[model samples]
Target: MQVNTRSDVGGKAEAMDYTKEAIADPVVERSFRGHKGMVTTAAFSPSMKQLASGAKDGVVMVWNFRPQLRAFRYANSKSSSRSPAGKEAASPVHKVSFSPKGDIVASGGADKAIRLWVPNVVGDCSTLKAHTGAVRDVDFGDGGATLLSASDDKTVKLWDLKKQKFLQTFNGHVNWVRSAKFAPGGAYAASGGDDKTVLVWDMQQKKSVKALKHHTARVNTVAFFPSGNLLAAASDDKSINVWDLRTFELLQHYDVGSVVNEIDVHPTGDFIISAQDDATVKIWDAREGRLFYKLHGHEGKVQTAQFSPHGDFFTTGGGDGQVMVWETKFDRSIASIKKKMAMKEKKAGSNLEEAKPEEVDAKIEEETEAEVEAEVKADAKHEGVGERVQAKKVSISEPAEDAEREVEEAPSSITREPEVNENYTEAAKEEVRPKTAPSASPANPSSSLPSTSVSGEQVMSALGTIVNQMNSLMEVVGRFDMRLETLERRMDALEK
Candidate 1:
């Protein structure tokens, strides 16, 4: 994944140091670091003026979004030397929501309580606690007249916002309900839970209108498309399943590499975004069902992904303790530029190929030697373990008999390699078997080693044990590689 981090300094005035891709990186931006635990959710105000985030710490922060966007805009400019500040550094908030007018903000937390705040006010807040368990999700209904909340108690409750009274409790899910979202029209809301079921409730009737049970694992999140005609679901089954609202029939199915924690459709319904356990937020073309591009940059699982009401930008809240804002950018002439660069590299490669084979081989040898030297230096600095473990884990290439033969031929070299620890070599030596066994006495050469050799039987047992251990180690290694690659890709994206 080659990223072009080169930002253009001579172009548009509104352009800041931030690229649309920068929004995808988890690094590069050091702001919004207050959350002490993994952030579980985030939402942007309808006006795009405020951002709300919630974390495992049972705290949520509602900050001014405009300044952060501007700071990113000026991050690469000569004026970027100035320090940046935020509107609010802390809040006693958990899950947050903005009213239709983007005035009042509502937050739910582990305290089994919900709080509403009037932003920028001296002392204005209303607290409500009706659920018996921590609230997992919250959303405002049509015109902010109603509020929907789901909890670990396995119930979804509708509340009258003005009266601050619980209106109804809908219960059908057999387990803890993890998420709930009001449909675009507020006529309905969808709830998903550990029971691997999604219940669509008709707000007016106060009953489930549909029960979707397609996921093989726990359902994580659900959302209604802009038209309110379709629903997108993310589940522990490691898939995103879209369903039609009119017929209540399953529609498209897309597999993300790991647990899909959250899914949101763009306001325009042209794209969809998924937050996954792999620490990646991926964007997909909704209508065409094609991957647009993967947005990388979260050090931990992406807890939530949402698009702004205007469809110009999207926000992501990550377990890494930060929120990111991504927007669209136009690449006017990237195709022409890449074509020219490709031709230049091709011409240079052809010119170099005309050299003598020995010289070319020597150059190749020199590069290889340089690589080996760097590897040795890196090993001396303690960078050998991770890559080596990853190599052994992935093992895309088969284990080489040549290396085993070389180890057999020069046992001392294997033991002397500076890259391997002394204890490891000693362990290998203890495990190695001699190529040939000692002969019996001349009178009975066939019975030299043992009367009835059990060594072969023992060797087979040891081989089986080793094979089992290797299989277990490979599984562990595969998980590590997936996680590490995900992290690196995210950091690289942030750096870009």
Candidate 2:
């Protein structure tokens, strides 16, 4: 099953921070339209070379990621029940999923059957039939040899694809099961249904282990975070719930205005994408729930949204029968994501030190000098991220000239409150928003993921340097103060 996997750009290099750039004018890079009816689902192959989409017209189409290549589609023939599975659209294909191996594609629809096809080779396919009603969704296991499926028959079924056998029926939902997916580790499975509940199943036992009853309406889809411990469920009730499997804790709950049809966490687990009834696909920061972008291209309601295996691209299926591909620019590939993070760290390091506090020029006066010495000693004695500045004792007999210089500098000591505050605020903002890594700070380089703060090491290092300089000035001040006291004592004794 060989298919063209070429890009239209033809192997040219792009900016390393391509995705970090501001959102493009036209959010959809390419739109693939072949379905006569609404699109139900879209999925990217593990290799990211192909995309498989299912439509309400019953066609399961496989396309090269490039727009130039034609799509290869297979559908069920309605004329004959025994006709070759390589036919035409007979009923709506509600969901399509690519196997982990990227070699096989699974699709389920109103036909009450799930089909596995090697998309590149149209006729080479098999069907697994057990659901008594329409099949709603299908997902591949971690190894791709097993599958989990939800159906209108009010059950989620597990299948052994290698043997083409029905493994077990996970029956807990009292209504139609809409979606089901295997955990990243394959230790558990989750399902959402019209029953208004999300069920977590222990894969080994093939039974529901926990139930989340929060959605006031139907649970449209369920997906597991890459870690396999966090489960996210979208609902017709206009909300998305993320819960931790270990502690059954509600980690995040978002009241999205539109009914969320489906949600997928990025491969990096830093962002989440949602398909909504508002015809908008939203990208969100998984940690903070911050909305990054509300992509608008679909003419009708969006039905399914998924991040590519690499997180560089995402696909959306809409009621307009169009499948849109989005370039996120933020690639989740280990090397690329790591490089992006490294660049962010470097930028933050630069910004944090960009506005360093200049040397604090203090006026030399009796009161001000005393205050300066006391403050310097206090800072020197403290153990902190700042370097331990040590104050040295000066010999009272050392030099009259040095004492005179100390007296001269005393008048220069004035509180630099205004200037210090100016740098403090800028550094503080940079300290809090490291992900913005505003290299204009090129005016604001924000990340789609949760923001990071500047490291304390750099800030402390700067403060340590300032403290060291202040401590040096303190040694001379002590000597000058002793000289004045000695002169006063001699003058008083002579007068007596």
Q: Which candidate number would show the highest lDDT if scored against the true structure? A: 2
Name model 1 segments beyond 4 Å from true: 1-31, 66-94, 121-123, 330-496
- Candidate 2 lands at a TM-score of 0.65
- Candidate 1 per-residue C-alpha lDDT over 38-66 given as tens digits, one digit per residue, 9 for 90 to 100: 87777778877777777765555676755
lDDT of 2 at 92: 79
Estimated TM-score for each candidate: 0.56, 0.65
In angstroms, how far off is 467's CA in candidate 1?
80
Q: Which candidate leads in TM-score?
A: 2
Candidate 2 per-residue C-alpha lDDT over 135-229 given as tens digits, one digit per residue, 9 for 90 to 100: 99998885988999999999999999999899999989999999998999899999999999999999998789999998899999998899988
